[model samples]
Target: MFTTGSVDGTVERKAFFGSMIFETVKQDDGALGITTGVENPVPLVILFLVLTAVLTMIQAIYRGLKQRREQLLEASDS
Candidate 1:
């Protein structure tokens, strides 16, 4: 997919390479579209970062709990 945009609007098209489906895109229900607006991807980027942070936090908590359990078992044995 490639896009060429001007202040007026943007021309967007999608094509599948090395696939027979590429021809279909040019026929009925063509993948060509025109979009007129400024695009903001910041929210999506922030959301991805937030999700990664949450995942890391969860992993850290799980590892800490596992380490504590091992320590408790070792202390009890001694």
Candidate 2:
């Protein structure tokens, strides 16, 4: 007969081990294309990289225009 504390400990251990087993199964060699509902995840990463590059280019252009305007104002004021 298991006491309450032992039962609780066993349950916690089981949960921990269960998660480890699940992760191992997920990483198995033949597990790549067998899963459902989950995507490959690489395309989303590529999309983010492309968006970041575009935003960086836009920021560079805006900064260049701002600096040019400031230079023009300084030249006129001098």
What would the TM-scores of all predictions be?
0.50, 0.50
Candidate 1's C-alpha lDDT?
0.54
Off by over 4 Å in 2: 1-37
- How do the residues 1-78 of candidate 2 rate in per-residue lDDT, one tens digit apiece? 112232222211122223221112222343322222223455556777999999999999999999999999999999
Backbone collisions counted per model:
0, 0
Q: Which runs in model 1 stand beyond 4 Å of their true positions?
A: 1-38
lDDT tens digits, residues 1-78, model 1? Answer: 433333223434433222211111122353444433324555556777999999999999999999999999999999
lDDT of each: 0.54, 0.49
